[model samples]
Target: LDPFVDWLQKRKIPRGLGIVIIYILLFAFVSLAVILIIPPISKEVTQISENFPLYYEKIVNGFNAFKSNLESPENTEQVQQGLNSLGENLSATVSNVAGAIFSIFGGLFSVLLVLVLTFYFTINEEATRGFIYTFAPSNIHPYINSLHTRIQKKLGSWLRGQLILSLVIFALTFIGLTILGVPYALVLAFIAGILEIIPTIGPLIAAIPAAFFAFLQSPVMGVSVIILYIIIQELENHLIVPKIMSKSVGLNPLIVIISVLIGAKIGGVFGALFAVPVVTAISVFLRDIIEKKVEAETKLVQ
Candidate 1:
């Protein structure tokens, strides 16, 4: 939004008008996406619900057969206990996700508050920056400004990169699922794209329902779906992450994974969503401090 406004400003448009135009454009894009996407997703969800009984039957049969094959009573009991625990955990997770979604939609006041704040900040970006700088020591103002700029740049890059990554994953998953004749391709792909925000466990979680649906169709199809997910995961890890995320965050994969886990542990979904950017900001500050310390040490030695 800022970039678009800046472009318009460079083209001789007033900042006020530029902001209005950007807002209109943003609204239109969101409206168009909802209009184009909602119907198919609704239909897919309906179909899934209608066919859920059959899928459930297949799952039950598979589980029963596996249990029967386990001859040792003790092992069989352990497996049953594990399955029960898994079911309970899955139920709780689903409930939490559903609640979160509902809460987001229900919180109109919160959403409007955010929009209002964004508008205020965007219009007063420079004033806001100067105001913040007033709190810091006058002598270190330059260092503080540099640090702020670096953090803002990294965060902006990260946002753009993440959006690109999600879109790419969505397209790729939709195509793969369509080719494999999977049900609810759009919804599943959307899920995969959205979950791509979570670091290590996201893709794995996205694959579960996809593979489960495929397995309901056939064992071979299930295996194929799993393979497809693995291939996509590998591509994302090796090619996509390197190309898109490497320059944006400049954090190691291990750091990202750990940050996400910590964030999730602390604040659940929203924490995980923001973990990387928060870490990036902290890293920038730390790097600046380290550089300043090294310079001082060098000066003392001289």
Candidate 2:
């Protein structure tokens, strides 16, 4: 904040005007990005909405055909019972899916609210930091400031790295699907990109529908889609994640999985999406505290 103010002061531009100009530019960049991404996303969404029922119908028919094959006299009762259970839950499943779809729209307002708040914070960065400093004791200010800096660095890096990873996944998925002659490549790849936000299980979720769609075309194509996604996931896990995310996140796979599960249980998709960063924050703070305590203890002993 001081550096920014000094830079503006050097140029003889008023601090307030500089801040406002920076905010405006930031907002403009964000708006442009949103505008560029939204049209293709909306097109894919619309296509999915219109065609999903037909896909579901085909899936149901396939399942029924499979069930018929299990109707040997010896297996009749077991198959019938399983089918009955599935039939009973079908409505509930549809209702849950509908609710999830509706929840996606519910997050739009939250995104807008974040953008607005960010604009305010950017314009008043020094004031906000000073106001926060007022509430803490002087003795702890240095530690608090240090912690804040570390958190910001970690989180900023994490977000940027995640964004790059998602973009890479989106490009690979789209290109692979296109080359394979898969229909709805744009939509499937977009889904893959967006779901990359959730680690561990996200890629698998994105792959299911893609494979299903490919299978609808032909079995060989289905196999190709599966192989393509497997290659993508391998590259993501072994290559991209190691290069981009490992340093930024610095969390074990087990911890991430646990945090994601807990977050999903508590706040659904939004919780899961943010769980890693929240855990990262906590870990960073605790790590800093422990190191400071050890340093203080060493000094006392000396």
Candidate 3:
């Protein structure tokens, strides 16, 4: 079956038939993914949209109640000061929230556009590569081609691994939240899934609201939520990440952190989403160059 598919990919089949097959496979895979994931996603998004203000109210009320329970006059003063600051920045915060929503929708559109473009390129991979190579100098064309292929494989693997990781985290989060009777479990879990793209800090950020909500229910529950999040993070790091992302990139933790920070600084969420893959591509190309140079010098000495 693999050999036959390779032969078909090499264009032994009629062009129209091959195109049909490609579309059929693409459709089937996409359909399967959507069928499996879209219902929970739609439910989560709908619930969040409808109840966001309610959740906000809960958080505000929780904070206010906690503030009232403070014994020290100094503590009350600090709380009042914090409230005043929050009020003063309310308009700016609202504006930032609107901008973030706009950015998220824009990013979603861009993702769809990219997926469409990728499908076209996948169907015409050789032609696309050839077109790119036409811009390169003849002497360096082979090197460029090799580098492109390596980058493509690295990025493709990374993307698939990332999707799997995110889905797993989302499922784990939703299940845990549901068990813990956390309100907005679906919404929080969705956020966790989306933030999983941001690498090291993503899970921690996802855990914040989960813990806060859990804390709102009870201090003990909150503590439990924190512990749950820590365990999930451990599982993701020690088990899921090793299995899924082991082949994707070779960058060390320090490089990954710096790249994520720089990416977020430059392009916000979109930049951060792409940081690891971009770094991986650059690292792979540079390593290849160094290896070639070393080989040349060794040959010269011999």
Candidate 4:
């Protein structure tokens, strides 16, 4: 045992272990950045898409009438009418832009805040890992270490893959909502993007806004949002999820549902946020133990 321990000390863990750890840290840093960065960006992007459209027609008519006056000076009545509309449109557009200038200014500060958070995670990854490692007992250090590696692998893959899935889901949702001429298409899309992070309940949470805002605007828009979410959710669950889940983490549908339900019930946004990662980590460890036991039994029989 001493000779084996001495050999372990002399030989050192493989350089590959260091590389993998670094890669995992980078992955976590970037994933956390997306969580931090995307929410604000989505808010700002949706705000631009939402509030701008509030005066979109005003902006459009302003430009159209201004152009008509320049192009066709022959008809005084048309030119005068165009000029009048242009003036009204311009007045409305100017006020809309001015009213939201404070929000635009505030947005810059939010961007900086996200950047600081992401950079902090990237640089101090080791400290964070150490903190997490302390949660497990010292007697089971090796077991906990193995579980830690497995959890990171599962989560990193899941998060990276989920990024693609969320974007696609958001894009599809946006197109459908926009086509239905939903009042706040961008806001719906942004909500869909964030909710898409959570496993089962996410899409439902996102759909509520689409339905509420749409129902307020028009019943048809409300129905459209519901149908759109259903189809998109189907596509995400059946096609995208199976295709993209790195290593096919093979979580039972029942387990996924239960985890999301319990998570949402317990901690609101945080529980939903962490539910899948916790489940995935547990699933990884269970699989590892099963595989190891089977191998040991097979070797003993031989």
Candidate 5:
């Protein structure tokens, strides 16, 4: 069965088909997610139709403005303006509400999806190896296998260290918020976990909202958020980062930072989130090819 599936995928399906399939699956998942999570859009939906009266007034005013403009010559301009204003307000309201609901839990959904995909890839290690071998030259198999092993080692080491650091950060964040009596402590902690996906700027961005929301509730709570995030971020940079990323993929910290920012700029949060892994994978393959070239040159010289 495995051989048949592999053969079919390789022969019948284009090489790009795998990436396309992954994207389609991702879209389907996100679409279903949007549907399942749609109810939260208007808390009005769950708590019953609260916006009905407001919507009714808008409709009524819209019609009234249209009718008055059509019938009364002297009031034509004022009525036209009223109708236009109403239309603009309705459009703005819909946009804002849509933005708010979507922004509410944006990265959380993506983080979970990435984790799911990563876990699947990790578990099917042999299948991935076989798939890659199918595309490589027979004599190059040994070199590819060796390089893949090296990448796996890098992945395992990085993931273990990252998890430890993530837990430490999560603990500090949750404890600080709890101590300050911040509302939605659990939610904030969860947000921190999700934000930890994007390097550097993620925690900082998450912290801003925590501080802002806290400020809305109480000035003291807001101050606490600022102080807590400051300490956590500093600790992350000095202690956590060094411990987890000490002997990185040999990329400069500056390069990693730049890649993350560029990725974020390109694809928003998901881009930033996947940037490091993608960078690491590409680096490994490129180095592997370079090493093979070096060996070939040395043999020629000999």
Candidate 6:
């Protein structure tokens, strides 16, 4: 957005007018996407609701048969309890995910707040920086600005890269699911794309429903779905993440996994979504501080 505004400014456009133009373009793009996507998703959701009972019956029957075959009563009871616990946990997880999604997309107030803040910050970019600088010592103002700029660039790069990653996952998942003759490929792909934001655990969670639906058709189909997701995950971890996120975040995969887990534990889905950027910002500051300390130590030794 800033780059686009800068381009417009170079063309002798007023900054405020340029912002409005960018906002209009963004709104138009979002509108077009919603128009194109919503209908198919709605249909898929309706179909899922209509067919869910059949799927549930099949699962119950299968579980019952498995329980009947168990030789020991105690073992069967333990298994039942484990399954009941699993169901409860899964239910809670689904509820949490749905709530998070609704909070993010359904909350008009949140969206408007973000827009307003962004507009204010962008419009008063220099003034905002000056205001912030006023709180710090004048000698360290340059350092603070440099740190801010670094964090901003990293965050911007990360956001752009994440959007690209999600689109790529969506396309790949859609193509794979379609080729495999899975029902609700579009919906599943959309889930895959959206969940790609959560790093390590998201792909695994996205695969569950896909595999469940595929398993309803055939065991082979279920296995294939799982395999497809695994392949995609491998590709994402080995190829896509390295190429897309490495430059932007510059954190090891282990660190990212840890940060995401910590964030999710603390703040749920939205926290996981922002964990990488927040960590990146901290890393930038830490690096700067370490460098300054090392320089001071070297000067003292000299």
- Give the Cα error of residue 149 in candidate 2, in Å: 1.3
lDDT of 5 by residue, 1-302 (tens): 12223444676764345444655686798799567534443343322234434544655665675676586675776766776786577556645755655685687777778866765664476788889999989998897788777776665556556666666776788788889987656556656866775567779877975785577566687887999999999988888788777864445455668888888899887887787767777778987789889999999999
What lDDT tens digits, residue by residue, belong to model 4 across residues 22-41? Answer: 45776699789778756765
For model 6, residues 211-266, the per-residue Cα lDDT tens digits are 98999888999999999999999999899988887777556556778997898688
What C-alpha lDDT values do all the predictions have? Answer: 0.81, 0.78, 0.76, 0.67, 0.68, 0.83
- lDDT per residue as tens, model 1, 158-240: 77887889889999999999999998889999999988866678899999999978888888989999999999999998999
TM-score of 2: 0.74
Candidate 3: worst-modelled 10 consecutive residues by lDDT:
1-10
Candidate 2 wrong stretches, greater than 4 Å? 1-37, 49-102, 246-280, 296-302
Candidate 6 CA-lDDT value: 0.83
**Candidate 2: tens digits of C-alpha lDDT, residues 106-143:** 87765566556655765676687688889988888788
- For every candidate, C-alpha RMSD to the true structure in Å: 3.6, 4.5, 4.7, 13.8, 13.0, 3.7
Stretches off by above 4 angstroms in model 3 are 1-72, 83-102, 132-142, 250-280, 299-302
List the candidate 4 regions with Cα displacement exceeding 4 Å. 1-149, 246-282, 297-302
- TM value for model 1: 0.81
Candidate 1: Cα lDDT at 192: 96
- Which structure is stronger by lDDT: 5 or 6? 6
Score residue 269 of candidate 5 by CA lDDT: 74
Model 3 lDDT per residue over 80-124, tens place: 788657645653553465466567667775556655665576667
- Native-to-model Cα distance after best TM-score fit, residue 19 in candidate 1, in Å: 2.8
Q: Which candidate is the best by TM-score?
A: 6
Per-residue lDDT for 39 in model 5?
43
